[model samples]
Target: MSFTDELSTVADPLWDAIEGHPMVERLGAGTLSTDPFEYWVRQDYVYLVDYARVFAYGAGTAPDVARMGTFAELLDSTINTEMDLHRAYAAEFGISEAELEATEASPTTRAYTDFLVRTAATGSFGDLVAVLLPCMWGFNETAERLRERGKPDDERYAEWIDTYAGAEFTELTTWCKELMDDVARDASDAERERYRDLFYESGRYEYRFWDAAWRQEGWEL
Candidate 1:
């Protein structure tokens, strides 16, 4: 089966749980719309810098050595597609690169990015997929849904939603899921469970990050 099929089979329960959350409803309905979306985007760009470094570490440390070449390709592509794109987003929000680079990541952002780095550096390929797939898949799912729900019609919200719903982002998510499915075909039960857990954990973190951002002071800009 293809990665989308495998993801649907193995990841549905987790996605269902996230989809059922009240917060997801709030976000999807635009009830949670606020300036923090802009703030969070800026914060996210800060986090991506560290993410790029970690992926670079993976490129340097892969045991297969040839895996390093694959890792480098993935890292470069991700940096260009994801990180560089985020920089564009920052500019759109009137945020400067100097400000983004100098700002600190939230605790949640720090922990999430650190997990990716550690997993990439020390874990098996399956383990890295377990940590990374959820992020890609969840963001893609949420952004697409928000886009379809007319978020792009709202002047203040269009850019944020459009960025992740774009073709490149969706393709990135699909690529990651394909990688995960290839690994899953022969993975141990424990390995599969780890991926499931990561998927759910990352989803929960995603919800929390938005919730926190919405509720933070001065979120009404």
Candidate 2:
């Protein structure tokens, strides 16, 4: 089995919960409240800011020019393309560019992004990929599964659903799977175990991120 396939054996439950999370369910059926969606978009925008840097680290740490190129492309897309979608969603909510820029990360968001940043800053290429794979793989996986239920007519949630389950993201997820599979091919058993654990933890954090948005969680002073 592929490393991701193997990781899924340990992580399927968390992935299932994330896939069936109430927030995800509501978005699919188009009954979601905009308040939570707005909060998610804001937090995710901040998350993506650090997310792009992880890709930058990947590019810097990559061995081959081809691998580096893909990482660089992802970095460019995060800053330029992925964020354009967030800017549009923010506009729909009457959230200004300045406000989105200044949006604070919630506790879960902070913890999640901080973990990713630390991995990219301090870990090996495999370590970085181990942690990063879940976000890349999980979001697209959730989006595709939700899309399979059919498209919703509600505009508020339709675009968000489409953005993930769409062709581009599907292809991106496949690319990410290939990246991990390549590294896993030669990884020592100890390293494979480490990657599996990282993927598992990242999956848990992904679920927490959605749950946090659903509950509108914040760190209390």
112-218 per-residue lDDT for model 1 (tens digits): 77767777778777777666677668777877777776764455356556767788778878777776777787888787777766655665666555555555423
lDDT of 1: 0.66
lDDT of each residue in 132-185, candidate 2, tens digit only? 888978888787788889878897677877888788888888888888989999
Local distance difference test, per candidate?
0.66, 0.89
Q: In model 2, which range of ten residues has the least summed lDDT?
A: 6-15
Give me the runs in candidate 1 sitting further than 4 Å from their true place.
1-34, 57-70, 217-221
Question: Each prediction's TM-score against the native?
Answer: 0.75, 0.97
The residue pairs in collision within model 2 are none
lDDT (0-100) at residue 127 of candidate 2?
Answer: 89
Model 2 RMSD vs true structure: 1.0
